[model samples]
Target: MKIFSLVIVLIILFILVGVFVKRRSIKIRRIKKEFSVSNEKSIMESIFHKNFLFFEHLNNTFKEKLLTDSYVLSKLINIDGVGIQITDEIKYTIFGLVGLLILGDENPDYFPNLTSVVVYPKMYISDQRGQNKSVNLGESWNFGVVVLSWCDVINGTQNFSDGHNVALHEFAHQLDQQSGQADGIPVNLNNDYYTWKNTFDKEYNNLLREMENAEHDSIDFYGATNKAEFFAVCTETFFEKSAVMKSEHPELYDLLVRYYRIDPMKIFSN
Candidate 1:
């Protein structure tokens, strides 16, 4: 009886080892597939793909560096309509890709840090009871979810006539949360927080004064709502009207370039 029991125990141990080994192997393969960097040829091919229409709007160098890169494309693909309601339209698919590209320079790790994206048909009414709108324009909840409205996103993009992308504006909040806080700033970028704070306060105050006096011409009035909104609004101008932002607010523009690690002004200028 003792001998038989010992043999059975050995067999069970062997099975457990095999199972562990198999699971480890599968994990390794998935990691490789998910994080693999795209080679030059792969990136070049992706740039020419019909789906990547946003590439045409970017400068050639940025186009080549970001669009041609497979790692970048993978991040874009990850922005699926998961865990959130969305309107049944082709634009959502296209906007998902465009939003990713707009934020591509932030590095893949920063793009989809949130577990899911919650999309709505239009500017959602704010949950705040008694509010007129049921969803807010864009918001990143305490839970790992980011919400956006398609109508606001489309208007922000098509109206490049103005500097306000609700999608970019909201996603910027997610980036700011990457370092564990959304104090109107993101980490991993080579910036002096002290200096950033000082400069941001000065500019923010000036903008607030401008907003009060109704002096500024472009961008949305909502930006003056608060510091967080200021950052989002400036991000819109940074990507959409880099030239104007660079010329008008050189310090702020420089800080934004450092934060995003990409000079969008140069990209748009090209």
Candidate 2:
């Protein structure tokens, strides 16, 4: 009886090992398939069967079915146990940001350190004793959490052309934080820091110089406050107002184009 029991246990262990290996192999193959093909519907079909629904079902945000790279889609789906109620619309927005991050590079490890995404129903006030202590639509923590207002999110989505998105702003900070301190410089750039600094410094100084007498007619005035904030605001304008930004700040626009691997100008042109 003891010998028979041992054999059964070994069989079960082997079965478990086989199952794990098979699933891992399948995941790898699917990810590869996702990258080489533009057939997003096939991927969706795969998700529909034997998949974890991040929510009961995402409510349509009227934003047409958007598709992203396979690796990016995996990262989006992998946020399963992230401890946040990311609805369908929020997921789409998150996917959009993820797609933007990966647009520059094939890798999707943008904001790799971030783990939590807390979405509030409305704007939340910060009472942290150390910080400036102001009511904000969104906040990004270096430790790992990003807080956002749902109302602002809806508004931002509705006006995709507007250079204002709370989530996008905070996520830009998260990208900045990957290096340490939200000083606007991102880690692991394909180009040297001098290029980033020069263009950013020129634009930032221009904003400040304009503010000395009167505000400039272009970009956001708030960006003049600091380099970090300037980068975040620029990122907003980069995606939302590509054509305007390109025409207004061609150098800055070119730098963003290289870094993000996206061309909002092309978007509007098309």
Candidate 3:
């Protein structure tokens, strides 16, 4: 009787696994179909081309991929606006910035664990850290949520050379959090872990030193706050001030190039 019960349990488990696999397969097929068929020409022209100077620099292939990835992300992530109405322009804009980050991946996860995005008309007050309220342009929570200020998001994209992007900075934290901790180290490094750690450590220390001396630096001074913030700040510089970063910090530039799998210098140069 026990053997029969064990067999029945095994059969149930097998059936459950089969159902899960089938559902996953169906989802993937639907995503692929949506990716291929979705049209985003109007949004590309109205939102991206008009505001995002970086969009103009990308080649046609990159542009198409960005649109597809952005569309996919929009479909996957739920975005809600607080004190503002959600619009396609806003959704595509946010997703486009994220799409740029994962552009090189053959099969991007599309921030699988991201639960939702919350946008505000402008800066919002948050006391998540403690009792003291602080104004923030954006925040990425470990609970799989990202909050943003729409005004700051537009400002970041419009000024392509500013080396400051709340979207890039916050989403970077989301990437860092994927390692199960927000300690500046990201996942999928494999054997490159040591190399990444070495470079990031050296650069992070150097930034701290520069901040102490009050010396002018290409990277943001806010990076000196912590290792995680340093990684996010470096991401901002890597994309916006690629030429300056490459010229000033070649090793760090190469590391970012390898990690992101895209050379912003080449794209921006165009």
Largest TM-score belongs to which candidate? 3
Tell me the lDDT of candidate 2: 0.66
Order of candidates by lDDT, top first?
3, 2, 1
In candidate 2, the residue pairs with backbone N, CA or C atoms under 3 Å apart (3 or more residues apart, or in different chains) clash, namely none
> Each candidate's lDDT (Cα)?
0.61, 0.66, 0.87
Please report how far candidate 2 places residue 237 from its true position, in Å: 0.8
Best by lDDT: 3
Q: Candidate 3, residues 164-234: lDDT per residue as tens digits?
A: 99999999999999988898998777777999999999999999999999988889999999999999999
Candidate 1: tens digits of C-alpha lDDT, residues 1-270: 999999999999999989966775565456445544635345344433443334566765565455333333333333444334443232333344344434446334424456566666666666733545554777765445667776676666565535767767776776667768767666565547888888888888888788789896454567678777777777778777777888888888898877776787555445
Candidate 2 off by > 4 Å: 1-66, 69-85
Steric clash count of candidate 1: 8
Model 2: per-residue Cα lDDT over 1-270, one tens digit each: 999999999999999989966775566457656655756544443432222121113223211222334244444343331234655455545555544545546544535577666676777777655888788888888886777777786677667677887767888888888898889897776556899988888889998888887965457888888988998899888887877888889989889888876676664343
TM-score of 3: 0.89
How many residue pairs collide in each prediction? 8, 0, 0
In the predicted model 1, the residue pairs found to clash are 43-68, 124-135, 125-133, 125-134, 125-135, 126-133, 126-134, 126-135
